[model samples]
Each structure stands twice: as structure tokens, then as C-alpha cells.
Target: MKGKILELLKKNKGDFVSGQKISEELNVSRTAIWKYMNQLKDEGYEIESVSRKGYRLILTPDVLTYDEIKDLLKTKRIGRDILYFNSIDSTNSKAKQLASDGKGEGTVIISEEQTKGRGRLGRNWVSPKGKGVWMSIIIRPDIQPIDASKITQVTAAAVSKSILELGIKNYIKWPNDIIINNKKVCGILTEMSGELNKINYIVIGIGINVNLDENEIPNDIKDIATSLKIESGKKVSRKQLVANIFNNFEELYEELLNKNEITHSIEICKENSAVLGKEIRVIFRNKEIRGKAVDLTDEGELLIENQEGKIQKIISGEVSIRGVNGYV
Candidate 1:
């Protein structure tokens, strides 16, 4: 009922909609509409109520509630069922639990803040209260466990394209991280629970620094992390960003699932790659190899050329671009 009221107000945004009209449209009492309007105001929505002009939606808060994002969403299934939380230990952990309980695919677990947020390599991800995007998605694909890593690439492409849609220049730091201005603004962690031949479910955790200011960023990662607000010089709408991500993700994921090919996603990754044609250091299993990132394979693997002119295909590793960020 409240969502319907919000929808009416949003449709007539910046204009007045009479209480009587709303009551007739939604079949609710005028007194109930008044109460709902008050509730929306308490939830941080700025609505103007005139003596005879009724209500006008002045501003929408930067919130991630389902009511806030439902209207913004344009995807078929990626975010249709969202489990939102004010604060949680971790969206990934909660999503994994739900998936183990036989939750359907495309169920999203999102939180305004994650008390125990973590990134790739188990590094602590700073998810300040109402400051960033901390969410996880549960998926049940029929592919083998070995093919699970491709989901990371697909997510990277989706995130890269979504951020690009916001007029922000960003790049995909192969396998999972999204970089802006040589600093990381987002990270993806893909975890799967299944046997060698059969797969049960996969949880893809995505953390993005959206509206955090300088003070909100931890001191340890200030040099290597940034937020969209810090880069764009404006506050970004988290709901819109979330919708864009789901829309792009659904498109790319459908391609991967239905057609069994991610050529479009691969093209997006290649076009926005941060390490292609650059000298890099690949660290895996306590071994470091120096190579030049030459190309990305059709299967989304990194192709590296060693100093000896030998090409090697890298599936997963910590790739650090030499001379950038002092990582070498």
C-alpha cells in the first residue's frame, strides 16, 4: 500500500496529487494516505503537502530499501527478490546460508552496511554505514565447478559497463577488481559450494565504494581505495546504480547461460581492461612471474608473455601492474 502511494507520488513527481485522488486510485482512506505520507517523511523522503494541492514528492533519500529500488529496477530476474538489511555481518555469508537452504537463483542479499565485510583474498572491506554498496547474489548454474570463475569475469563486465553508464571512467583489473584513476573502487568475490562435477550454488559478493567521503575511508587503504562521490564530485544514487548493475548483469548472465558464450562480456572487459599491453607481475602459490599482459582469451583467461617470449594462460592470480601503485 505504501509502495503504491510512493509510486503515485513518483509518477507525479514535482507536481501535486490530491489526497482524494490517491484515496480513490488506491482504494485507501484519506486518513490512511495522510498517515502513509507522514511515514514516508520519517523515512527521509521529502514530500510537500499543501492545504489544497495535496502532496508533491520533493526529494527521494539515498536509501536501498526495496520500495526505493523497485521502481528503478528494469531487470527480469536478477533483483526481483531482494533481501535488504540495515546492517549485517556480511551479505556474502547471509547469501551463502540462504543458497544452502535451497533458495532460488537471482535472489539478492543487500545491506546498507556490513559489519564483517570482506573482499577478495579475505581482506577486510570497509563498508561504512549507509556509505557504500555491499551486496551478494545467489546463483545456481548448471556448469561444472571449474567453470565457476567465468562468473567473476561476467560480473566484472557488468560492473564496468554500469559504472561507465554513469559517465565515470573505470577499468576492470582482471578477474575481480574495478579501478578508477588507478585506485580500486569495487571488488568482486565469487564463491562456490559444490562437488567437482556437480554444482549446487554460487555466491557472488560485490562491494562498491559509492558515497563515502575521505574521513569514512580507513587510513590503511586511503591510498588504494576511493568512492564514486570522491571521483565524480557528486553524490551518486545508490538505487539507480544497483538497478543498472542488475540490468547489465542479467543481460550478460543470460548470454552466458542460454547461449553458452560470453563474447559480449569479454569484449567489454577487453575494452576496459587496465592491464592489457602493460608489464605485470602475477603472484600465485607464493611464486611471482613477470610478464606482459598481451591479450584476454575467449574463455576470459589472461594471456601473458614472459621475458623469454613464451605465452602463458593465467586463470587466477594476483596481477599487479608494474610501475603503477608501487605494486612491483
Candidate 2:
């Protein structure tokens, strides 16, 4: 109801909308309209309410409000049902709970800040208030569990493509990281719950350093992590970035499902690849293998030739790939 009222007020921007007219249009009583208007004001919407003139939306806050995002959404399924939070433990945790509760595919859980945010390998991710994009997408693809790893690559491709569209030339560090100017700007973590033959659900958690200042980053990771604000020297609209990601992700995901392959996504990763053709060190359990990243196989595996000159295809392991020369 509040969303509807807000929409109406926004549509009638720069002009006063009478309470009686609002009540008539929404089939609500005048008192209900007044209550909704009050709620909007509390949410930081500068609404002017003159006794006879009704309500006029003077300004809207730059928050990632549901109504604001939904108004700009262009996807068919992804983000159709968005669960937004001002603060949370983690978007992935909330998304997993929603998936268990039978939330449909493409349902997104986004938070302004994550108190217990995490990255791949259970490493802590610093997610301060309004500093970056912390969100997870729940998907129920009909692919086998063996193919689940592909989703991570798909997410990397989607995010990298979105960054490129924003005029930043970025590259993909095989598996989950997106690098810009040798610094990591984005990370993706893909988690799933399913059987060997069927995937019940997969949650793709994406964290992008968007508007954080250099001082906001932790001292330990200050040298390796960067934000779009720092790189582009401007503030970015999280709402627009989120909407663009959903649009790009939905397009690629639908293509994968319909054709049983993600050729386009794979091609994007290869083209913007930071690991391919670079010397790398693959850190697995108890051992580190130095190799040169040759290419990404059709199945999205990293093909690397070890020091012994034997090319190996990596599907899954404790494999933490790092550029031998620098952090890519």
C-alpha cells in the first residue's frame, strides 16, 4: 500500500495530488492516504502536504528503496521479488533462509551493510554502511550439481560485463574475482544445496566495492582492494548498478538454461581474463603449484600448465589462484 501511494505521489511529481483524488484512485479512505503519506515522509521522502492542495513530492532520498528499484527493473524474473534490508548479518544467510522457505528463483536479498559478511573460503568481507553492493541471488536452475560451478563463472561474467558497460575496463580472475587496475573490485561466492543429480537451490552472493573511500578499506587489504568511487573519482548510483546487474544476469542465465551452455558468458570471461596467459600459483590443500594459466576450458575450468610442463584442468579443489607477478 505504501509502495502504491509512493508511486502515485512520484507520478504526480511537481504537482499537488489531492487526498480525495488519491483515495478515489487507490480505493482507500482519506485517512488511510494520510497515514501512508506520513509513512513516506518518515522514510525520508520530502512530501509537501497542504490542507487543500494534498501531497506534492518535493524530493526523494538516494536510498535503494524497493519502490524506486522496482520502477526501473527491466528483467523478467531476476529481482522480481526483492528482499531489501537496511542492515543484516549477511545477504547470503538471508537468501538461504528465503530459498529454504520456497522463495522462487531470481529472488534477491540485498543489504546496506552486512555485520558478518564473508567471502570465499570463509574469509571476512568488510561491508560498511553504504560503501558497496552486498547482495545474494537465489536460483533454482535445472542443471546437475556437477555443473553448479558454472554459476560462479556466470556471475563473474555478469558483473564484469556490467563494470565494462560503466566505462571501466576490468578483467576476470578465474573463478570469482573481478580486477581493475590490478586491484580487486568485486568478488563472487556461489553456494548451493542439492543432490548429485539435481540442484534444489543455488545462492550467488556478489560483493562489489562501489563508493567506499580508500580509508574505509581495512589496513590489511588496503593495497589490494579498491572501489569504483576511488577508481572513477565519482559517486555511483547503487540503484542503477543493481538494476543493470539484474538485467544482464537474467539475460545470460536464460540463455544458459535454454541452450544448456553459456558460450557468451564464457567468451566474456576469456576476453576480459586477467588469469589467462599469466603465470599463477594455485594454492591447494597443503601444497602450492605454480603454473601458467593457459585458457578456460569449455566447462569453465582453469587450464594451467604446471612447472613440469604438463597442462592440467582444474575443476574444483582448495585451488586459490593468484597471479605470480602481482595481484590481478
Candidate 3:
């Protein structure tokens, strides 16, 4: 009911709709409409109420609620069904649980803050309240479990394109990380539950440092971590970025599902690659191999030419660029 009222007011933005008209259209009493309007105001919406003319939506708060982002979204599937949260243990955890319960594809789980946020390899991710994009997407792709790593590349491409569209220069660091000004801005973690021949579900978790300031970043990672606001010198619209990611992701993912290929996504990753043509250290298991990142395979594997003049296809590993951001 509140969402309907908000939609009506947003549709008639810059103009007033009579309370009586709203009551008739929504089949709710005028008193109920008044109550909802008060609730909107309390939620940081600047609504103007006139004596004869009714309510006018003046401004909307910077929030990532379903009602806030629904109108901003342009995707057909990726974010059509969103589970929004003010606080959660982890969006990825929730998404995995929901997917195991037979949730369909393209369901998004978003949260304002993650109490137990994590990154790859069980590393803790700092997710301050209202500071970043902490979301996970549940997808059921008809592909083998071996190809699940490609989803991380797809998501990295989508995120790179979306952030570039916002006029911020960024680069994809191999399979998952998005770098801005040579610092980490976004990270993608793809988790899958499936058999050898089939994939039951894949949860793509994305955590972006969107609005955090220098002081907000943890001191341990402050030198290597940054936010979109820090790089862009202005506040970024989290809702718009979320919508853009979904829009780009849906387009790229459909191509993969329908054609069983990720040529376009791989191209994007290559074009905006941070490690390509640079020396890198591939840390796999307990050993580290130094090589020059030369290219990305069609299946999204990292191609590195070792010093011994042999090229190795790296499926998954922690890659540290030799000279970038002191990552080595």
C-alpha cells in the first residue's frame, strides 16, 4: 500500500494529487492516505502538503529500499525480485540459503550493511552502514559447474562498464576486482552449489566501496582501498549504480545463457584490464608463480607467460600485480 502511494506521488512529481483522488484511485480512506504521507515524511522524503491540492513529492532520500530502486531499474529479470534489508549477516549467505530453497534465477538480495561481510578466502569485508553496495544475485544458469568461474568475470565486466558509464575511470583486475586509480573499489565473489554435470545455483556477491570517506576505510586496507565517492569527488547514487549493474548484467548473462559464450564480457574485461601487459604473481595453494599477464581466454581464465617462456592458464588464484598499489 505504501509502495502504491509512493508510485502515485512519484508519477505525479512536481504536481499535487488530491487526497480524495488518491483515496478513490487506491480504494483507501482519506485518513489512511494522510497516515501514509506522514510515514513517507518520517522516512526522509520531502513531501509538500497543501490545503486544497494534496501531496507533492519534493525530494527522495538516498536510500536503497525496494521502493527507492524499483523505479530506477531498467532490467527485465536481474533485479525484478529484490529482497532488501536494512542490516544482514551477509547478502551472499542469504542468497545461498534462498537459492538452496529453490529460489528462481535473477533474484537479488541487497542490504544497507553487512554485519558479517566477507570476501574471497573467508576474509572479512568492511561494510559500514549506508556506505557501500552489499548485494548478491542468485542465478540458475544451465551450465556445468566447471564454468561457474566465468560468472565472476561477467560480473566484473558488468561492474566495470557500469562504473565507466558514470564517467569514472576504472579497470578490471582479472576475474573479480575492480580498480579505480589503482586502488580496489569493488570485489566480486561467485559461489556455486552444483554437481559435476550441472549447476543448481550460482550466487554472485558484489561489494563496492561507494560512499565511504578516507576516514571510514579501515586503516589496514586504507592504502589499497577506495570508494567511488573518493575517486569521483562527489556522492554517488547507489540506487542508480545498482540499476546500471543489473541492466548490464542481464544483457551479458543472457548472451552467455543463450549462446553458451561470454565473448562480449571477455572483451570488456580485456579492454579495461588492470593486470594485462603487467608482471603479476599468481598465488595458488602454498606456492607463488610470477608471470606476465598477457591475455584472458574465451572462458575467462587468466593467461600468463612465465619467465621460462611457458604460458600457463590460471583458472583461479590470487593475482598481485608487480608494481600496482604495492600489492606485491
Candidate 4:
């Protein structure tokens, strides 16, 4: 009911709609309309209430509120059902819980900050309030468990495409990182729950540094992590960025889920690859292999040729590729 009222308020953005009219249109009492308007105000929406003229939306906060998102969202799915949080432990964890609770596919879990944020290899991710895009996308694709890893590739392509649309020259590092000027601006962690042959659900957690202050960055990774503001010298719109990501991701997801194809995403990753044709060190659980990255397989595996001229197709592992002869 409140969502319906907010939709009405947004529809009459700059102009005021009478409380009586709103009540009549929404089939609610005038007091109910007043209560809902006050609730929106408490949620950081600047609403103007006049004597004869009812509520008028003056401005919306910069937060990722549902009303703000519904205005810009264009995808048919992916973000239609969003679970927004000002702060949380992790969007991925929350997304998994919702998926388990039978939430529909394409539900998105987004947070302004994550107290227990994580990255690939179980490392801690620094997510400050209003600093980045911390969100997880819930997917229930029909592909088998073995091919589930390709979802990460799809997410990488989506994020890289979104950044490139902003006119930033970025590269997709193998497996789950986006690099610009040799520093990482984004990371993705793909997790899933499934049986041997069937996947129940997959959660792809994406974290992008957007406008974090340099001082807020952890000293341990300050030299290697960067934000869109730090690189572009301007504050990028988080709302637009998130919307763009969803649009791009939805296209690729439809291709993968409906067509059983990852060709487009694979092509994007290869075109913007940061490690291909470069020397790299692949870190596995037991051993490490050093080689030259030759190409990416159609399934998005990293193909590396060792010093002994032996080719290795790595389906999953941590890779350290030189940006300019050393770590970025």
C-alpha cells in the first residue's frame, strides 16, 4: 500500500496532488495517506505538504531507496524485487537467505555498506558507507553445477561493460576482477548451493569502489585499490551505475539461461582481458604455476602456456598478472 502511495507521489513529482484525490485514487482513507506521506519523509524523502495541495515530492535522498530505484530501473527482471539496506553484514549472505526462502529469481540484495564484506579467497573487502556498489544478484539458472562457474564470467562482462559505458578504459582480469590504471576497482565473488547435477541458486556478489575517500581505504591495500571518483576525478552516480549493471547483466543472463550460450560474455572478457598474452602466476590450493596467458576458452577458462611450452586450461584459481612488470 505504501509502495502504491509512493508511486502516486512520484508520478506527480513537482506538482502537488490533493490528499482527497490520492485517497480516492488509491482507495485508502485520508489519514492513511497522511501516515504514508510522513513515512516517506522519515525515509529521507523531501515531501511538501500544503493546506489545499497535498504532498509534493521535492527531492529524494542519494540513498538507494526503493522509490529512487524503481524510477530508474528498466530491466524486466534482475532488480524488480530489490532488498535494499543502509548497512548489512553482507549482501551475498542476505541474498542467499532470501533465495532459500523461495524468493523469485532476479531478486537483488543491495547495501550501502557491509560490515563483514568479503572478496575472492575469503579476504576482507572494505565497504564504506556511500562509497561503493555493494550488491548481490540471485540467480536460479538451469545449467548444471559444473557450468555454474560461467555465471561469474557473465557478471564480469556486465560490470566491465557498465564501466566502459562511463567512458573509462578498464580491463577484465581473469576470474573476477576489474582493473583500471593497474589498480583494482571492482571484485566479484560467485557462490552457489546445489546438488551434484542441479543448481538450486547462485549468488554473485559484486563490490565496486565508487567514491571512497583515500583516507578511508585500508592502508594494506590502499596502493592497489581505487574508486571511480579517484580515477575519474568526479563522483559517478551510484544509482545510474547500478541500473546500467542490471540492464547489461540481464541481457547476458537471458542469453546464458535461455540460449545456453556464453559467447557474448566470453567475447567481451577476451576483448577487455588484462591478463591474456601476459605473464602470470596461477595460485591453486596445493601448488602454484607460472606461465604466459595465451587465451580464454569459449567457456571462459584461462589458458596459460608454461615455460616448458605446456598449455594449461584453468577453470578456477587465483592469478597474479603483472600490470607493468610488477603488482599494480
Q: List the residue pairs that clash in candidate 1.
A: none
- Where is model 1 poorest over a 10-residue stretch in terms of lDDT? 65-74
Query: Mind giving the per-residue lDDT tens digits that candidate 2 earns over 1-328?
Result: 8899888888989999999889989899998888888888876799998998899999997666668788678898998888888899999989999999999999999888999999988988999987789999999999999999888878888899888778878988888899777778998989999987999999999999999998998888877788888988888888888888888899888878998888888999999998787777776666666788898887799888987889988875433346422445
TM-score of decoy 4: 0.93
True lDDT of residue 119, candidate 1: 84
Q: How close is candidate 3 to the true structure, as a TM-score?
A: 0.94
Candidate 3: lDDT over CA atoms?
A: 0.92
Q: What is the lDDT of residue 41 in candidate 3?
A: 88
The reply for model 2, stretches above 4 Å from the true place, is 316-328
Using lDDT as the measure, name the better of candidate 2 and candidate 3.
Answer: 3
TM-score of 1: 0.91
Residue-wise C-alpha lDDT for candidate 4, range 1-328, written one tens digit per residue: 8888888888888999899888889899998888988888877789999999788989877777556777677789888888889899999989989999988889899998899999887888989998899999999998899998799999999999998888787999888999987689999999999999999999999999998777877887877888888888888888888888999999998999788889999999999999998989888887888889999988989999998999999998878876553644
lDDT of 2 at 140: 99
lDDT of 1 at 158: 95
| Pairs that collide, model 2 | none
lDDT at residue 85 of model 1 (Cα atoms):
85
Order of candidates by lDDT, top first?
3, 1, 4, 2
- Alpha-carbon shift of residue 297 in model 1 (angstroms): 1.2
CA lDDT of each prediction against the hidden true structure: 0.91, 0.86, 0.92, 0.88
